[model samples]
Target: MQQKPLTGRLILADVARGLALLTMAIYHFSWDLSWFGVVDWDVSGSPGWRLFAQLIAGSFLFLVGFSLVLAHKSGIRWESFWRREIKVAVAALAVSVATYFIFQDQWVRFGILHSIVVSSLLALPFLRVHYVFALLCGAGVILLYHWLGDYVLPYRQFFWLGLNSLPEVSVDYVPLIPWFGPVLLGIGCGDILHRYDLLRLLRGSASPSVISRCFAWFGRHSLATYLLHQPILFGVVWAGVTAGVLSTNAGDVQVRSFQQSCVMACSQTVDAGVCEQACRCTSSEMMNRGVWEDLLTRPNDADVREIAQQVFQVCLRR
Candidate 1:
């Protein structure tokens, strides 16, 4: 089944990808809005929202591969692609550097765009390979992150690799190991579509379904929409706060809940009790300082650890 170019099926993929991008924006807006005294969602110190965000990341990356194959269904064309790759790569690096400038304390050293740029560069080699081989590579990349964890696999250097048991000093680092693997899977899937012309069917080649059209439209311009959605969501959330649509009281229950999430995220260093106690005190002080929400939403590792330590002393006195 050979797929036609830019058919209904392609538009469907866009819509799906667009929805996923929108999901990510929703999460970020929820997070950012919480900071400006808007909606008080437990984004930072909560398991559910964290998982939601991870799912969003995984879907986005997977689709990146999916879309890559669909776009270049003919074959890997470096001459036409390299120029754009450099542009996106530079943009990604600029993001890291610029983010560092903005939030020196908790900068995003390697976020989603960085992963896409790196994966795009690395994926060229595997492009012509058999789809099965590509899938195997994807599996290996994801599994290696865990198999090689205990022996210290150069966190600083491979921080982009995402295979660390103890990741450091970053807000949302999507490393290469596991994350890149998805890109490969997407490519494999893309090739499968290309070989069988399944892309058209998936893109709405078979029948022009409304749902298919929606996702495809999204997939086409995911990059732009993803970049723009956050500011708009933030603005809306900000307005909600200003109009008092959302309350501004994240008190003791919130603190205890926050402590639990922080401990779970950081108890890997043989100091659970310390993290626990300090979290309690930090919560107390932060609440007193009227910055409890701030602590939950956008705190750095130093600040996170500092709070953990402060409460740990309470354990010593006890």
Candidate 2:
């Protein structure tokens, strides 16, 4: 029996974030459907869907910037800042661990939460400076990504920086370079909003509609919702598959799934170059020897297992 007027902590910013969350849930649901073979096209891979995802990621990062400024513009709130930072960092670690089990190879190495936490830490220096400086710095970083994209990195370890080209195997990779631009821009926008009293004006005039209230509620509890939504969606899809309500061809699904998972998992232990080659070689060799079915059906078969291992070893050497 918890009841409080929604208007008490309500703000336009919360509703805006809520809307972003709603869209994000929808995007993930669609992606989950594709993963389950409910759809023919890969929602996460399609150009339109990819663009949609970028927009969602951008919006979330922008809000991260905006929220950072809103909380600390008066002066740095060291206590509150660290408290929030710890929560975000912990949630990010949780995501990495969970995804490691669920998606192993393609687990979220440095996904959105990881990026946000790092970006927030990096943005601390700019908080006390002029907004224009942050805006320009952000713009410069974005351009730097484009400029650096043309050069080959001498070392592969720094791929997480997002300045180098790497195999597109990560399930959710949001490198720091271009992505941090939005956050910096958001900080600048926050300054503009505060200086003009925009946030106060928006909050003062907000209508207490049910939709608005619900959105605000979701926005307020965004972190918890973000953590839970994916697992729930995944469970629902798994249930459907178990109930035979949704049918997927085992071979196509399993092969693609295994290859993708293998590359993603392998990438963690090896460079992207080696992982990609090994996975491609392994999957191809399995398919070529007409032993893919045997491997899938009898994973413990000594002969097939030996052949798979040999392929991996050869791939690594090459």
Q: Which segments of model 2 are wrong by more than 4 Å?
A: 1-10, 150-152, 204-206, 258-318
Can you write out model 2's per-residue Cα lDDT over 183-286, one digit (the tens) per residue? 99999998777766555654744467898888888898999989998889888988998999988666556766766766666765566656766776788877
Residue 178, candidate 2: Cα error in Å is: 1.3
Which candidate leads the pack in TM-score?
2
Residue-wise C-alpha lDDT for candidate 1, range 103-181, written one tens digit per residue: 5645778888888888887887676778999899988887886676534553556667764445544556688877888
Clashes of 2: 2
**Candidate achieving the largest lDDT:** 2
Clashing pairs in 2: 105-264, 105-265
Clashing residue pair totals per candidate (backbone < 3 A): 25, 2
Model 1's TM-score against the true structure: 0.75
Question: Residue 40 in candidate 2 has what lDDT?
Answer: 64
- Residue 164 of model 1 has an lDDT of 48
Give the Å shift of residue 42 in candidate 1: 2.1
* Candidate 2 lDDT score relative to the true structure: 0.79
